[model samples]
Target: MVLSQMDAGKALTAAAAKGNPEEVQRILEELRVHPDTLNEFGRTALQVMMMGNAKIAGLLLEKGADPNVQDKHGIAPAHDAARTGFLDTLQVLVEHGASVNLPDQNGALPIHIAIREGHRDVVEFLAPQSDLKHATVSGQTAVDVARASCVPHMMDALFAHVHS
Candidate 1:
């Protein structure tokens, strides 16, 4: 029996998780699976790209995946990419219209997650695009997280945006 679209989507998610860009490409091309197809966890292919390489993210974006689609926790693909230090992927999502200030279920912004994960570059890239004053679920702002974590670059980025 032929696999349904949902099965193909699951396969795409698996391929992405394993960093198998070719398999993802084949599934997108051959199976005609949706680029933004949601897996069992309600995470779209774009969210899967968060932990994967830049190529897969780019391919998914090219195929029309919505960067803003959130997972079960309300964390967008941009949040995951930033949290995991996937700089290029984060950039692509941002360029493709992912809102930097969009918060997750925990109300944590992308910059907050970046700083939490010690991904300074991601924090720097996102800070300027976000409001440092926004608070998270834990009652902490981006500036607060940066300071508490002692991430100088993140702190500097936030201050620059705030003072500018």
Candidate 2:
């Protein structure tokens, strides 16, 4: 019953995975945990939220969790959100100063990850603000990744954004 006694990092991660804002805030208030604590895999609560927890992501950002923290894989929280096409999460991170251009270990930016995953809406959202010519691990840009993944709409969107 004592949420404070629970592992704050674990609780935060679980809350992030569940997108439970209330539980997350409770953990923060009761546990006095560091919001940016990384898990064994080097993922922070914000990163976990970016993976799929829009509510928790918003909460964490509103609570002042660092938006620029990277996982062990060197992927920023925004990158994870973009990779998963979590538009709301991405927006929250962005509003909190998450760098839109941070690259992952493979040199893939958030837009590149979104394109590789064939997330058309994410690509559409990111395209206007991104440099589609940016390269990745294999020297491929978002358009190249979209083309290889057979996502014609993403490729077209990137192309249009880059050209226009």
Candidate 3:
């Protein structure tokens, strides 16, 4: 079925948000919608997609979705995945060319968000790939975020990566 761009965006974004990979696939394959199509809210499927769904993340990315697509807040899929502690989904996004160094509106990179959110696994995955020197608008780097997170050993985890 042919769907207008608006309808297609809505349908595709909705399917992604619901974590229904099959429905997302059907919408993309059958509807022929662009993988980066924006919903009515001006957000892409990747932006609103369930962060825990690595399968959906892979499918959308395999279909050519923009891994770096950011929302109005400048939060990309990687940022969302880090914030939500979905390391697998984040890895998929990074494999699809998402940049761990991309900053949000607050100048916080994915690593910064992972540290602040106490997502140690996510932080570890991003640590080697991220520019550890980057600082947020608030002047916080991954180290600073870890210090404030109060999550025991968060700093040690970052230190392990930093030293190596």
Count clashing residue pairs per candidate.
0, 0, 0
Q: How far is candidate 1 from the true structure (C-alpha RMSD, Å)?
A: 1.9
State in Å the error of residue 9, model 1.
Answer: 1.2
Q: What digit string (tens of lDDT, one per residue) describes model 1 on residues 57-153?
A: 8788788888788877898888888878988888888888889988899899888888888987787788778878889978998878988997566
Q: Give per-model CA RMSD.
A: 1.9, 2.6, 1.2
lDDT of 2 by residue, 1-164 (tens): 44332356777877777778788898777776778766555567887763666677777877779998987678888787877788877877887888878888988889988887877877788888777778887898877788788766776767777773
Quote the lDDT for 55 in model 3.
96
Residue-wise C-alpha lDDT for candidate 3, range 37-156, written one tens digit per residue: 989998889999999999999999999999999888899999999999999999999999999999999999999988888888888899989998888998988888888899987898
A best-first ranking of the candidates according to their TM-score comes to 3, 1, 2
- Per-model TM values vs. the true structure: 0.89, 0.85, 0.96
Candidate 3, 29: how far from true, in Å?
1.0
Q: On a 0 to 100 scale, what is the lDDT of residue 4 in model 1? A: 76
Task: Find the 10 residues in a row with the least total lDDT in model 1.
Answer: 43-52
Each candidate: what lDDT? 0.81, 0.77, 0.91
Candidate 2: give its CA RMSD in angstroms. Answer: 2.6
Cα error of candidate 2 at position 2, Å = 9.5
